[model samples]
Target: MKLITEKAELFFDLMWSLQFFINTELKILTKIKNRKEYAALPQKDKQVVREKIYEQPELIDKYIASNPDRLNDNHLSIIKQWKNFIKGDFYIERYLKNHAIFVGDNNVYGVLGLHDAFDHLFPSNYLPIYVKTILLPFQGRIVYDGLMQVYQVSFGGGIKRSLSETYMQAKQNNKIITTLEKTRVKIESKAFVEVEQENIWTNEIEQLKSLSKKLKGGDGQPAINSPVFSLVKASIALADKALFDPSDIDALTKELQKVERAVRKVENTLDRML
Candidate 1:
């Protein structure tokens, strides 16, 4: 969805002021006499100035030092954060309720739209649209810098599915970047999740083993002493083994089928005994 209206206005005000400052400081564009003219310039012309600012990120510091607008510390802090900007080609993979998904070379960003929602800009069938843009931190969210260069390259079904998978992987791993400042926290959080997931599986397997041990046949004999309970114990053992290497899909499938068959045979055997 679009950014909050007031925030969007503040963004343009600060951004336009800074770009115009850069233009004059570097004389990148001579014709742009004022912020009004600079704002009205074509996206391509604005892109030229935008690239220059990024190329020399030190300009952001210079602008902060100048503080020509006499902006408050909070507002200047927002502008100073532009130094952490991420620039590259990204695929606009999908649009969700809160934010649209922008998948880059290695990071997925939850980017908010400016004046219009991303879905309104590009139809679902048109995605994953490839575009070159700059992702900046605004307030506490990620947003593009009001200019995008879209490529006309069309993707086939395979590439489309691959891009979709990339988005899903980032989501499942909790790796979708929401803020530029918390990037380090996100990486450490991902590692914690991975360890916790493995521990969950390990605990489940141990519980299963304990349950099997309590299912003794009789007179303190192991459950395997009885033909009927042997299948039940085997099923638990197979499940424990399967959990150890959950990533081996084919192997896990085979183990699961074996466990199902063994349990079914035990059910039938008990029916005959009764």
Candidate 2:
């Protein structure tokens, strides 16, 4: 969804005011004398200054050091946090009730829109929208710097499914980053624990899948056409489904029992062959 009205206004005030100060300090837009004048300029003109500001991110540090506007310590802290900003081309993958999914190079971010929700900005069919923008930490959440550059390239079904999978994986693993202040160690550690727990329960099914790969035979051998591999493959599929939705404990238990029986039959077959 969108940021709160007052918070969104504060974000604009701080962000634009800082950009205006950057323009004045660097003399990029010499004609713009004050904040009011800078605000009056078309978005295209402001975009030019925004690009230049990010080009030399050191301007952010300089602004923090100078504190030209005599902004409060809280405001300066918010500006200082800009050093941790993430600037990149991201896929605006999907929109959820809480935040929009921004899939970056190696991470997924749950980003809040400033004045409007991402769904309002880009139609559902247009997604996953490819865009270049900077993600900033604002009031303990992640928000993109007000400017965004969207690419017009269309995606085929394959690419769309891939993006959807990426979003689902991020959500399943709790890997969607919601704040810039979060440490990777913390996020990864939690994800690791959850994955490990899930893997423990499905370890036997996974081993069966691996063993089926080894049992695969080339050419027209009997092993190539064995029904055992089919059984293992189906078990693996059921295991995967159970992994994603393990709500019905009794159903999962019955599925695991069937898989265990299959595992025993495979083990007996291998014993006799050996």
Candidate 3:
């Protein structure tokens, strides 16, 4: 069994904690949005309504305080704005009209988007379902995209690439473009993981070994022509890895056995469509 080092364990713990915080914040925002008072508030006054409805301002404060190094100028500005909104420091309509430029922006969403991408690539469930090798690069791409948004106000750029847009472009070109393409784009844009610039994509995948180390199980490979083939291959690769874990080997084996059955069922259904 490969023993998880203390540093690796700590890093994983931090990743989990960050994911939890992002989910909690998203829930709070959703709750505020669903409130009747939120709907009744004037368009400009909604920020105030959100502030009044959100119960845990301290959580936001704590996050900012703890992650000073992670925050950029845009993050600091948003934090200040949030603090002001929470304190009810300005007249609602006037403040809204004056700060109309910042009305729809929420830095928290960028953070949440980053975490969501991480979860998509490396699900926290017992049976993980994505290839670390393939997913890590995509994960980096997602982080880059999220950070761009988080610092968008302070850092002016014409436009940024979207994962969905990139996927579509790949499909149109009849290519199964993966992480290599994103890396090339990052290099061309001169944004190839500069941590000093608050880019988290740097070194995120350095520890990951190649997928070849874990791809020795199934005969059922996804069709390269499929638009979502990359994702499907990733999932299969993950299942394969889980089935062969050195420790608790049977635990993942049974879980992925179930997944294999499900995949077979789906394939049979698709076969009928032919």
Give candidate 2 misplaced runs (Cα > 4 Å). Answer: 182-274
Candidate 2, run of 10 with poorest lDDT: 222-231
Candidate 1: regions farther than 4 A off? 183-274
What is the C-alpha lDDT profile of model 3 across 52-153, one tens digit per residue?
323455655665666633656554433323332211111001011111101111111011123233334323331111111101122222112111111212
Sorted on lDDT, best first, the list reads 1, 2, 3
**Winning model by TM-score:** 1
Cα lDDT of model 1 by residue, 76-145, tens digit: 9999888999999999988889899999886888999887888888987787899999999988788999
Write candidate 2's Cα lDDT for 127-199 as tens digits: 8889998999887789999889899898888988988898888888667788887564476678777776765
lDDT of 3: 0.33
TM-score ranking of the models: 1, 2, 3
What's model 1's overall lDDT?
0.83
Clashing pairs in 1: none
Q: How many backbone clashes does candidate 3 have?
A: 0
The top-ranked prediction according to lDDT is 1
How well does candidate 3 score on lDDT at residue 125?
37
